[model samples]
Target: MVRYYGIFFQEDGQWSVRFPDAPSVNTCGETVDEAIEMAIDALSAMMVLGRKGREYGDPRGYEEIQAEAKDGELVFPVMPAEKAMEAYRPKKRINVMIPVDLLDRVGEFLKNRKGLDRSKFICNAVESHLQQNVEAH
Candidate 1:
């Protein structure tokens, strides 16, 4: 679990949220709840990028933030929602060898579908198979 400190403030009739730990991440919404939800997505995306080798800025100290916050600004603790984190997590690449006949059959099956690549199709199929087997057990 990763936690970061965020500042929530109103700007031009919209609620905006930004994390001190990651200045590059920010989001805006019409309501405070929406803003918080968007902030979680933004934070999770940043975490995903960081895991994929992106550098982030240093986090500000609480005292520094206390001294820096202006009127109407509120400090809020933010954590990435599990769903967001899972959805945004970086994908890993793997090498696999398949029989030529099977590969041709898979390609023929995907020919009618638009934008369904082999890797995604195989990943989804494996995941579904695993889920069904686990549930059966």
Candidate 2:
């Protein structure tokens, strides 16, 4: 888990939140608690994008942020929970062709591995093969 610093403040009677590390992320709420919850949601969304290989700016130091903070502004840290990460991993279905013998072997192997499923096993195998070939080049 990674912790990110956020700036929370009230503006026009509404609480707003922004992450210095990721300026693109901003959220607002009717109350401080609500603002924090919204900030968590925003952070989770950003983490999902990062997991999908999106780039973000580096975080600002807490001291620097403290120096720059306006009156009534507060700094808080937020981290994406495991449930958030799991929720972000969306799965897709695809069709592939393979030999009947290979399919049978895979099925047998999966049956032996209690929690492993066919799609996950195949995906892992393909990813491993691709990585090996890429490294060989």
Candidate 3:
């Protein structure tokens, strides 16, 4: 786990955080503590982007970072609780073509269902089918 120093700035009663090592990484919150929490999420996303771009950089030293801080800007350590990609699991949107009759049936099934949707139904059906196939094999 890499430790990056975050520079916290308060403006208009909101606390915002910025990482020097990653200029694109930033977050804001109503309070300092909240901002720190958001910093973890922001940093994790930055790590993922860096990995994808193949342009990741090492964290700068605290002394060096502190020296660059402004008069009221607070410098502190911000480390992600988990690995970069593990911290954020982005869902992918897929477009699937189903028979007109099947799509109509799905709409009817979900019409009265309070929480269930067509996508969730399809996912559950796929998972159950996969499990059954695995067991059969």
Candidate closer to the true structure by TM-score (higher is better), 2 or 3: 3
Q: What are the per-residue Cα lDDT tens digits for candidate 3 across 67-134?
A: 98999999989997675455465667988889999999999989999868887789779989999999
Q: Please list the C-alpha lDDT of all candidates, in the order they appear.
A: 0.81, 0.80, 0.85
CA shift at 41, candidate 1, in angstroms?
A: 0.9
Q: Where does candidate 1 stray beyond 4 Å? A: 51-54, 57-63, 91-137
Clashes of each: 0, 0, 0
State the local distance difference test value for candidate 2.
0.80
Clashing pairs in 2: none
TM-score, candidate 2, is 0.59
Expressed as tens digits, the lDDT of each residue in 54-111 for candidate 1 is 4665566677665667888987777888878767767888889999999999999999
For model 3, the superposed segments whose C-alpha errors exceed 4 Å read 51-56, 83-87, 90-137
lDDT of 2 by residue, 79-120 (tens): 776666655667788888999999999998888797678887
Which residue pairs collide in model 1, if any?
Answer: none
lDDT ranking from best to worst?
3, 1, 2
